[model samples]
Each structure stands twice: as structure tokens, then as C-alpha cells.
Target: MDAQEKIAQILQRLETGTCTPQELQWLQDWYDNQPALPMHTFRDEAHKQQLKTGMLQHIHAQLEPPVHVPVVRMRYGWQIAAAVLAGVAGICGWWFLNNWQPRHKMILVQVGTGQQKELLLPDSSRVWLNAGATMEYPQEFSDVRTVKLDGEAFFDIKQDEHHPFEVHTGQINVQVLGTSFDVKAYATLDETQVTVKTGMVKVLHEQKGLDVLSANDQLTFSRSAQQYMKSKVSNQQISEWAGGMISLSQAGFAELALTLENQYGVRIRFNPAEMKQDEYTLRCSKQLTITEVLDLISSIHPVQYDIKDKDITIHRKN
Candidate 1:
């Protein structure tokens, strides 16, 4: 048989605990004669030993118990058997590097201005990201489903009571199990809001639990003041942005400007001194062009707007 075929047969025998002593010796000799694998560098000696022990232990657990081998030789036989398994696992050189390596790949998704995105996570959870938002998640979730968000997202998580889902933002961490919720935690905005539409959510700050919210419940945390307020919200307002609509109530100039920037993929520049502290309540369709929305605003309030190719300037009418 060819060298690879012979090696495969030997490994198969070894895995099944049917390798004779002579076959075991021959396999050991083959491994010794083969070229060494490209060694993975470790941070420290202790870390290296720790990983080695873990791999060997895992491989050993999968192997069938040795048969017809003397008790005195069991220890040495098992060690050699594990080494053979490791060597076989390194067949393509790539498998060993990827599987035996101690790193988990993380993926980052960024939504550009005026754009929205939808993702189905490994756990079958669905997320809808708003414009000007970014999210980070591991390629595969572990014991706990965790994701980081820098803007706003609506999450409909699948039920897994054993593995609670977590959303980490700037000011707060939200934990849930099979729930639908919306989180608004833009870095530009001073306040972080967590609103639940269904199921229960637990919000925490700095590892301390802030409040538990149920359906139609909202928790607002002010970053600047380091304060928390829990209030009731209408279910329709929970994730209205995801449905091609923008709604605001008692919103300030900055909030309005930010919403416009994210929705239109434009930059807005306005002088705070020239603008009044007028709170605007707007419910408009996201399909409206930047100029159209600005015109609508002007009709309601006496304000002049200048639009120049993805940039807008607003000032109070003199």
C-alpha cells in the first residue's frame, strides 16, 4: 500500500484499540521519521503545557480502551497512542492549526449611513440593525450567546433557557432568554435605552443589575448623569425604525440631526446658538428624501435649510 494508505490503516487500528505491539512500535517509528509539524508558539511554558494536556486528554477520551496490553505498559501505550492521534490530526497541517489552536474568530458587521441590515446568528436568533450601527459576534457562539452593539438593533432570539442571550453596549448589558427587544445605545447619544416588546429582559450597568423589564417596558440610562429611569412604552414604538418609519417625541436638535444623518447617509451641521430648544415630535416615513423631510420640517417650523450633496445646514429663519 502507499505510505498515506498505510498510515491511515495504522491510525484506524490504533483508534479502535486493535493495534498490536509491533504495529504500535512501527507507527511510533513512522511518526519519528516523518517531518515535524510547524509548531505553534505559545505565550508561556505554563500555557503551552496546559494546552497540550487538554488536547491529549480530549483525544484519549475518544479512543477505545486498550486491549490485550499489559497493565504495566498501559501508561506508555496510551501516551504513544495519543501522540499518534495528534500526528494523524495534523495530516493536512491546516486542521491542526485551525482546530487545535486556541482562538475563536469574531466577525464585525457595520451598517453604513441610510442602510439597514439583517442577520441570522448561529443560534438561529434574528437581528435587525438600523443605519449607522455596528455589531460584533463570534463565528460560533459558545455556552452563552453574546454580541456587542454600537448603535440600535432589534433582536428576536430563539428560546434557549440554558444559554441566555446577552447584548453588550456602551452603558448597559442586557440579558434575556428567548425574547424580542430593542436596544438604542449610540455613542453619540448621552442616553442608552432598552425597550422590551415581549419576554423579560434584565439590564445591568458595570456588572450590577439595574432593572428587570417586561413587555412594553423601557429603561433609560443617562450616561452623563449616570442615572436610570424605568418607564412604560407603547408596543408600536419599540422598534419602529426597523419598519421604514422614524418616530420621535420631545426630541432635541441633536437627536433630530442624528436621526437625519443616519437615515439619509448625510452630514448635518447646525449652530446650537441659532437653534431654539424646541422639542419636535415627528412621525415620518423613511422613504422621504432628505430635502423632502427638511421641507416638511420647514413647513411646520420657520427654518431654512441648505442641502449640498450629502451635507445639510439648518438655521433658524431671521
Candidate 2:
């Protein structure tokens, strides 16, 4: 095979979860043969089962050959049961081939409304996406660990000293060697919030070419101000979004309103005076409806609201 075709074969193996160390030489061979080829294109579940463990049998069947082959006897001499299970495993193997073909799946996981999802990346990293959040990644990571995220996600990244993970969101670029962190970058909001939970993070503002973030730090990049602010973080406030709670400590009234609008998909207006405030603190549950939040605000402060269709509202709530 030509260099290109050979490299393509190695890539296919890498993507299909079948590549072995012996194949490393194949990759090097492809590279060595690159002089004769074109430049390049940069590229690239758990179950429990026992007896009545149909899932395992199904998975096993998927690897069986089309033609019948000689089989070994079971140590327990349960040939009858083994035969039945083998047939089931065979059918499963076919089902996997036809329906579950890996064909380079770009897996994206997300959550909406009162839902949440936990995902395990091919690199053994973990991600928890909050409601109205999403993560897009490949079925297998290449030389680099790259992902695109929107809304909010908590990442417990796997330590990879060699290749750091990069998170691309809205207008911010976050890179990390290995750390647990949270990011909130919804388009509806005017700012993207990055909070470092452990280790260090580097936040880059793509527009202005600024990088800001480190261990135990909180960073906010504002679209309106076109500025970056860094401060020692009180992690709890920044990470509340991942817990289905919005805790805005020292958040401006306008910022608070913006967060509410984005999370609930509603536009709210506070009596002009409220918007003029420099800041305010709010701790509200994500599960609460906008009306409930407003009601709570009304009880605590001299506030009233004109709710209309749960879509838009004029509020005097403090």
C-alpha cells in the first residue's frame, strides 16, 4: 500500500479501538514515507451482566465469524447452555457490526431542562454537564485532548503531562495540563465564567489575545466591557452552576438578570433603578421557576413584578 493508504489504515485502527504498540512502527513508516506523499491533514459505556446476562452474550456474539467454527468445551461441561449463549452472542456481534459501527463517531453529550449527564472521555477523564449544557468530543482522542463546550460543565481532567486538554467555548480558550474546573459560557450571557477547582488553568481571550487563569482563581471575560478580570476565587460561588444553583456573590443586578434570562430562557427587566445598582448577591435554585425566584425576592425586598406569559416580565424585585 502507498504511504497515504497505509497511514489511513493505522488511523482506522486508532479510531476503531484496535490499535496496538506494534502499529507504532506503521505510524513512523507513514511519516518516513511522507516525503513521497502530500503534506497532511491533521486528524482526529459500561454494563453489568452475569447469567441472564444477555448484554455480555450479545457483545461476545459480535466477534464471531460468519461461518461456523470449531468450539472448545466449557470447563463446567455446560455445553447446552453455552451453545444457546454463544448463538445469542453471535447475534449480538452482528447487531454491533451493523448498528454500532464506530465509523469515527464524534460523540456529543448534553443535558436540558431538569436533566444532567455524566460522560467518560476516551482519555479516562470525566465531565458532568449541567442542564442546558453540552460537550462535543471524538470517540477517541488523538495526540491532543480537545473539546468544545457550551453552557456549563465540570471537568475532572485526566493528568496528561505530555498533551494538555484544550476547551474551546464561545470566545474563550481554556487550556489545562490536568485539573478539575468549571466553565460557564452560554451565549445568552454577556460573560464567560471560568473557575479553577484544582490544579491550574490558562484562559485565553481569543479576541484580544489575553491569557488569564491559575490555580484557585476566578476569571470572567465580559463581552460588553471587552475586559478580563482575575481574582482569588471562592470556588463555591463560581461552581454553583454545576449544582443546579445560581449563586451570584457580589454579582451586579444586571449580571444577575442576565444569568436568569439565559438559564430560564426569559427576558426580565428590573425597575430601571435596580439595573443601575453596582452589584448585588443572589443564591437561587435552578429548579425554581422565574416566578418563584421573583416571589422570593419580593418577600425579602420591596419588589413587585408584572409577569406576562412566563416569557418577559417587568420587575421591581430587589
Candidate 3:
């Protein structure tokens, strides 16, 4: 067989997890000797990266068993590199496929009200799904690492320089190679926000605009105004929710209510319309129960709350 054909066979064995160590070494040597191909060999730069990422991830998976790490403790750069390697691996496999078949199996992770969940992707990327959030991803990421998110999440992505990790929300798309960031894009909210804690993130709003953010940078896109605002925040602690802490600075009552509902699994109703204008700056620890939180809020604001089962009603104090 020709060299190209031989390399293809080796890659097939790798994919099936059947490649002998000798075969793997030969494949590696052959790859090292090959000339640098044009980027156009794949559909786009992103696709090219995805292929590289996939290959690297496959290699690692073969060489080492998966290591389970807390989502918050994962190494940011390594996660990104792993994602990029996956892309490269995918490209290598795709090039040899005579007839490609799509993988239809998908995985959906949903966090119920007042609950949070942690997920580990096949590529070793970690995701923390906040309360009342849902994430949809493929059982196995092939070329690219892409996920659809509704509500909020904090991602500690595995690094692969070639592939980009993309999180799609209703109002915006957050893309990164390897980064730690929080994305809040609930459908009910008028604004979608992305906060970067480490590395860099690219936030896209279709044809409207795009914003690239670095550590401690935040981007907010207003769906109603179709405008984006960028700011540097001193408190990167917003992501602390993943660790059972809630911090807010001059946040409006509506936001506070939503947060409480999500974190406590309660339905909160504010009466007479004026409560929406109420704002507060506060911090709550996980030790505080939902009732305690409401009590704390009522102590500061001119409001009283009545809790009945899972429902809460707040009214302006007379």
C-alpha cells in the first residue's frame, strides 16, 4: 500500500483502540515526517483545529486512563489544549473516510431548580451547570467541541490549540480554546453576560457584533437594545456560585429573585410592579437557607415576604 494508505490504516486502528504500540510509533513517525499541509485541507481553521484536538485526545485516552478532577480545580490551559487536539484528531480521521456516517447519540444534562450538577466531557473538559440550567452535548465530540446551553454555566475547558470550544445560548455564543468563564443567557433575561476568569473568550452575537474578553473582563449583550457593553470587573467572584456562594453588587430585585428561585428551587412573586426597581448589593453563603435569604433581603429592603410551600410572595411594606 502507498504511504498515505498505510497511514490511514494506522489511524483506523487508533480510532478502534486496536493499534499496537509498534503501529502507533510508526504512525507517529510518519506524521512527524509529513509536510505541513494547508489549512484549507479542512473546512475552516476551526475545523482544522478540531481535527488536531481529536487526535491528541485519542492518543491521551489510549495512553492514560481518564482522571477525574473537580470542575473548579481543573487545569485551564491543559483543558483547552485537549480540546484543540481533539479537532486535529478528527481531521486526520475524516480525511481517510470514504463514506462518513454521522453519530446521532446526544447527551443532555439538566439541573433542576435549586440544584447544580457537574459534568465531564469525553475530552476531559469540565462543566458546572448552575441551578435551572440545561446543557446539550454530543456523547462524543468528533471534530469540534460544541454545546448548547440554557440558563447559566461555568466551564473549565481542556486545552487544545487546534479546536475551539463553543457554548451556544439564545442571545450569544461564547468561544474559547482553553478558558475558565461563566456564561449566563437565560431566555427570560433581557441581557446575556459572559465573564472570563482566566484565558480569553470570544463572545459573538451573530451579525450584530463580537467581543473578545480576557481575564476579569465581562461582556453584556442587551437583547432589547441589540448592543454590547464591555467592562473590567474587580470581582471575578461571580463564578463563586459553582462553589455554593452567591455574590451580587447593586443587582436589581428581579435578578435577585431569579437567583434565589434558581438556587433555592422556589417560585417567587413580587407584587405591585415597583419591586422590580429594587436593587441590592449582598453576599450569601451556602449555610443560609432559602427562608433566611428572603429574611435578609427583607431586612434591607422595604419589603415583606410570605412563603407558602415552594411559592414565595413579596410585597412593599406599607
Clashes in model 2: which pairs? 61-89, 61-90, 61-93, 62-93
Q: List, residue by residue over 26-134, the lDDT tens digit for candidate 2.
A: 4443344433322221111122123226533432443332456554422332333344343333333432343334424688887765566788888999988876787
**Model 1, range 1-318, lDDT digits (tens) per residue?**
655556556556644645555565666677678666556545466755665565455445444345654433334666766665555444423333443232257889999988889999989999999999999998877667999999989999999999899999989999999999999889998888899999999999999999999999999999989999988888998888889988776667777889899988889999977774677778899999888899988898778998888889999888
- Candidate 3 RMSD to the real structure: 16.5
Candidate 1 Cα deviation (angstroms), residue 268: 0.6
CA displacement after TM-score superposition, residue 116 of candidate 3 (Å): 1.3
Candidates sorted by lDDT, best first: 1, 3, 2
Candidate 2: regions farther than 4 A off:
1-104, 207-209, 252-278, 286-289, 299-303
Worst 10 residues of 2 by lDDT: 39-48
Q: By the lDDT metric, which is better: model 2 or model 3?
A: 3
TM-scores vs. true structure, each candidate: 0.69, 0.61, 0.66
Question: Any residue pairs clashing in model 1, and if so which?
Answer: none
Model 1, CA-based lDDT: 0.80
Pick by TM-score: 1 or 3, better one: 1
Please tell me which model should have the higher lDDT, number 1 or number 3.
1
